[model samples]
Target: MLHPALLDRLCKTYDGRKILDDISVSLAPGSINALLGPNGAGKTTLIGCLLGLLVPDSGAVRIWGENADKLSPETRCRIGFVPQTMTGLTWFRVQELKDYLSAFRNQPDGAEDRRWADWAALDPKARISTLSGGERQRLAIVLALRFSPDLIILDEPVASLDPMARHDFIALLSETVQRRETTALISSHIISDLERICDRFLVMKKGRLIGDLSAEVFAGEIRRLAIWPDTALGLEVLADLPDGSVWVRGWRPELDARNLPVLAGDMEAYFLALTR
Candidate 1:
């Protein structure tokens, strides 16, 4: 069967600079994939291309075995998205907006997953303008998750939420993914927020994907070796290791060389290896 989402040799450029360079990947069904990169690394551009908001110069983005740019309205509604930031629509009351969204969500032949307002705990009469940043984010999340979309794209979803709210959001996200077998792609700089939930990672650099691997494989490949050299070799002790390993500062030259890789270290270290 064809993949649910595919970006095949996608390329996009703006002005004189390239925004995406030969991007190609297929997102697995029911998988939580994290997309990571530094600023200006073309993450947003790639997402735009996927959503058919921006056309790639060459190649294609396919959703449900059909071209994304020309997806039928019914197919399009099956996808959900939460952008990095939202604005305007501040005049609508919380329940007013939910009612408006619900009208569009329940098409004649569409799947129904309703009552997301309750999932988000948004006050019915609250004005969008009066809601806090976290509350706004919560509302956005509910809108995206309400349909139990076949595929969900979240860009920096937890950046504005508090610690407890972040946890709760992840729990909600996980529950949705598990219950409905949803495919989710989340782009975020908050590694800690994504590390536990993501089953796969996509690392980008200079408008190109540098690493794409399952979370388990990534953990095995990028290891933190704590070294203690008996002799004064300085940094030369790690001169023969692979390229991705980082030189942690716990090394002691005079003491015994304790060269052991820590289990389940921070995902940030792996990201650093890809970017640097």
Candidate 2:
């Protein structure tokens, strides 16, 4: 299991604008965590730090009980990473490429090797150059699974795949996560895909951690609340709610309020008051 603690990243522009300011988060073991953020939110930078591809200006990345920077080659070998960028040239053949990768990592011996190959349905000799984008993605995925790593990090792994391939990939990932007892951190802009397998999601905006919501919490806490402001002063009154869960949709008077569904009125009212 990989217990990750990202302390903070302080990135500053030449103009003195802070790009990433005091970001921090902890990732638990055996959990599927989705990092959701808009562009320029520093998701890529954070991933780079996790993968040891980039050093943070100011931060600590810890894995399990030790610092990530001090991880040994043996520890590093137990991690599988699939970057958003393509790994190799399209000219390479699939089977040939996978075989080359297999030689680098020590896969399980005996029947396990056959089982892993069969699991991905990858023929050892197929030309990667002939595969489609989805096929390439699948091949990359299988390559990542080759060593049975304890932790897998995927960045937009399904973006290039078709709907069916995407579905199959998620299913395969779900099965692997349970069977192998592996933890995963997948970053994707697709909300629906993240909603499917992610136990929790970390929301980021402008390089800041904006929200941390579990799937169940999101389903229960996020709601559409409608309100009609009686006066200009009414907006000010509603701004004092407790939970700070409100966002203004628009400014209008005499809202019909017919479309409003039955909700936890207390929470909705609380949100309205707080974010007002």
Candidate 3:
């Protein structure tokens, strides 16, 4: 079966610096995947290449087995994107903007459109320019999701939202994706929030894809061990640690025969270990 999205040996550079280097990954259908990395880790660059907004210097992007750069209107319509920042369209009122966008899809502004707007608690008469950051983000999400696209890509989507709004939005997204079996790709620094919905994790650093693993496997395999600071024995033990194991400064009474401590198996810790 074809993947919902695929990047094959994708690379991009800017101003003599490599922004994405030899990155390749596939997004499975009906799954919510999380992209995790610090600033300048090439997360946005990778998303741009995948969406065909920015051309890659090398490699290819394919969506549903078709070239991303040359997707048909029908194929394009099946993809929804919520960018990190909502810009432009500030001159239009909420309802007018919705009508304008709906016209492009040949869809009438009707009950469904109003339903989404109501869910977002967006006022029809309010101008976009006057909306708060969280409200603008909500508007963007409502627009992206109203069409019920087969695939959704969200970049830092919850960055501007408050705690309650963020929780509600995530819950809504989770329900929608599961009910429709839609594929989703979310990039965010909010690790705990992502952990609640994501089944897979992708880690990047210095424009390179450092780690990719299923949440189950990541929890089972990646581990944090505690070791004493003063002992040459601890240093010796560190040398024989399994590849990818991370050690911390502490002690555990329940060491295995090889002196390996029990696994901490934290998502944030795993991400930090890979990026570090």
Best by the lDDT measure: 3
Report residue 214 deviation for candidate 2 (angstroms): 1.1
In model 1, which range of ten residues has the least summed lDDT? 232-241
Is candidate 1 or 3 superior in TM-score? 3
Expressed as tens digits, the lDDT of each residue in 171-192 for candidate 3 is 8888878987999999999999
Q: Note each model's CA RMSD in angstroms.
A: 5.9, 7.3, 5.0
Please, what are the lDDT tens digits per residue for candidate 2 over residues 1-276? 446434444442325655566777777767788887767777777777777776667777766655666777777878888777565666667666766676777754445455546655655567777776666777777777667778888988888877877776787777777777788889886767767788887766666776665766655544434343335523322232334333333323343353443234432243223323
Per-residue lDDT of 238 in model 1 = 22
lDDT of each: 0.78, 0.64, 0.82
Which candidate has the top score in TM-score? 3
Candidate 3 C-alpha RMSD relative to the actual structure: 5.0
Q: What ranking emerges by TM-score with the best candidate at the front?
A: 3, 1, 2
The per-residue C-alpha lDDT of model 1 at residue 38 equals 97
Where model 3 places Cα greater than 4 Å from the true spot, the runs are: 106-115, 228-260, 263-265
